[model samples]
Target: MTQPIAQPAQSTVPASKVLDRVLVLEMVRVTEAAAIGAAKLIGRGDEKAADAAAVEAMRAALNELYMDGTVVIGEGERDEAPMLFIGEKVGLAPGKGPKIDIALDPLEGTTITAKAGPNALAVLAVAEEGGLLNAPDVYMDKIAVGPGYPDGIIDLDRTVTENVTALAQAKGVAPSDIVACVLDRTRHDDIITELRGLGCGIVLISDGDVAGVIATTNEDTGIDIYVGQGGAPEGVLAAAALRCVGGQFKGRLVFRNDDERARAKKWGITDLNKQYDLTELAKGDCIFAATGVTDGSLLAGVKRKKSGVMTTESVVMRASSGTVRWVRGEHRAKV
Candidate 1:
């Protein structure tokens, strides 16, 4: 006889001067709620609708936190998104709580969720005031690897084969055993061909660059490195995740048009070609949280039961302590 599970409660607020540790699970709630909200829309074949559902839910959850949080990276600019816009302030008592910067993706893989594909996620990154990079929403070229290799083992300036070869040597493994995860797009065809020539294994994802970047950090992922072009906002978010888990990540802004470059300049980016290392992207102590919307590596998808309960899987990380906690929650439907 199985009884209905109790409703999930709030996060554990560990004592700390800064809220990184205390707010770890609070951050998870933001993503978990968004994932749960978006999960209901899965396979509905409406990308925008699903994204909107997630954004609304995430924004509502963040507003309940006890922090003076600003949306540094979010749905879009102030004029673009209704909620969670860049520069928008969240939290119940804005000036009365811990000050922090937030970067988030309400529905990371919108198309994937619409198609019921894998790896869709709801993610958020938090840092003390001025800790996170105020990245504009634009394309960025990125390369990353999990911790344990010497610095400079993989350089973005190098060719794909050269980077893979160097990484294999650093791991002391054969090239064929080194698996790289890259976004599956037409732009990556050349990269794919190059890796194939070098006898490297490649895992291609349709979307969710945040998960794609963090996959390298977990040995279970079997991803030694990740390389490709993705959103700049996501790069900063990924860097924050790596900061908590021990990894090396580098990204450079990629502008497609003069307007894009102009926007970068607006955000105080003086050098278009300057590469940003992990610390440069997310400095000091920070926390990152992500919840899986659909099943994929790194985390599991949200599930619903006949008892009107939903289950969510999430990972929360704090850079100051290098603590990574995986949270599995069962949420009861509101009465």
Candidate 2:
């Protein structure tokens, strides 16, 4: 059973105005709730249950906020999940808060959770009206790198080896010094083989490409580059994160058929050959938050303490200030 959401105070303040600086913390709690929900189902061998719990918890947490939020990018279409669908209205409807565009993955890595793999996260990004891209649930060819690199360091049009050579040249290192991350799919066999033959190191991930993309930002992660095809919605979300933090990201949507192309057109995407740069994918004042559902390089997974308390790790970033925060929360049992 689902519960109805209560209306918040009517202050005539728009969500976008308040969200950049004020509501970022509240947004972290939303991802935390979703992570906790999914963490409970970790290693349960039921990916569907884990995803459902996360979607439900995330929806409930979102509805408690004061803003007028729309799920611009979500699980699926209206016929998909009962909630958090694309174009679904969330939060208090018609509230006095600003209108915000939300892109979220309640459970970014369902397969990772079922297998208790690394790099699973609950991630979301919020921007002002028309700030985030209205991307469909389609595959996106993406390439990303962490901060401090010159702009145009990575380009999708270039071959994998050429891109690696460019990055190596920019970093003043040998091609072998670069470490790349790619999804472990047969689709990437040639890409992986070429990268390996170039004397570059490759880290293969089963799922959770969002985390893999973000890893490029952390020098400690040793992921010099991320190149592969992942979700378009996720591509927008990652671009938002890179926008907040310092990084370079570029993505191009991949369509399988006319139906997929039509779906993109339905979302105002007319440029079938468009390659989105960072600013184009996510722009304006934006906030990004991600909480770990399973232990990964970006954040730690939720843990249940022996004393009846639950702990979780989260990272929240604001593009307005280019500030990033790491949060550790402990949940005490309620009577």
Candidate 3:
């Protein structure tokens, strides 16, 4: 189960502390390590094993870094996961470097990896202290669109059809020409139905909402918008990705019962119904990094050669510079 984070007293760290550009590649290395770790378990049909392998690899890699970091969005509570749990401290030596907050999904698609499906990835985001939202592990209602549209083009409060129609008009295409990505879950049937009724194309992914949300920003994916409900932690991670490139994202917490609401309150959220934009979720020059564990639209999967060599594809982006770098690596040894 997910644990609520204890709000810390305002840190003395200056708000202007900029994340070093080199950390971007470091993040790529971290995700690559995790992807390779999980890739070894691909098609094994053991989701738990795959996820545990990823968590172990990612935590090991993070600990080798030179900064003082906290796992804001990690596996779960200290009791739920022995390592990489929320509030777990990482990095080489504490108090020796910049204070960084990390939000990660060691393996974004556990079932996908277990089944050797496409679009599996190892994902994480980093920002200066207090930069990322400490979102509880609960459902989040989300709506997002790619760049070049008006600032307020998509609203969570609006109907799916209306948002899709508005996006179509902005792209100078008919509603039927618009493509929206959504998770294939019973909870989103209403959203799927509305898009179908509007003649909008829908991409229903079985998992990995982070990739689904990020797909909107990549024109090659032909995904104009993404809408539905998913993990709130993934929502913050996806928002970080959009922050680095260009996009608009809005998310509202969805609590099913009193316990869920109590978790939200523990994380310092008072306005349960308040819609959060991209900046609100991630702020202050954050970095987003992802490595494909399996082939998909966003990136190529890790490939192993017969010569005991492995290749990985990753993308690392920084919000401050709006710089996005695609890295292709050939690891002489196992990542």
CA RMSD per model (angstroms): 5.4, 6.8, 6.5
lDDT of 3 by residue, 163-207 (tens): 888888898999999989999999888888888898988999989
Model 2 agreement with the true structure over 272-296: per-residue lDDT tens digits: 8888999899888788999998887
* CA error at residue 17 for candidate 1, angstroms: 3.6
Q: Model 3, 301: alpha-carbon shift in Å? A: 0.9
Minimum summed lDDT over a 10-residue window in model 2 is located at 1-10
> Candidate 3: minimum summed lDDT over ten consecutive residues — where?
1-10
TM-score of each: 0.93, 0.94, 0.94
What's the lDDT of the predicted structure labeled candidate 2? 0.88
- Model 2 CA deviation exceeding 4 Å by range: 1-20, 93-95
Q: How far is 109's C-alpha from truth in model 3 (Å)?
A: 0.5
User: On a 0 to 1 TM-score scale, where does candidate 3 land against the true structure?
Assistant: 0.94
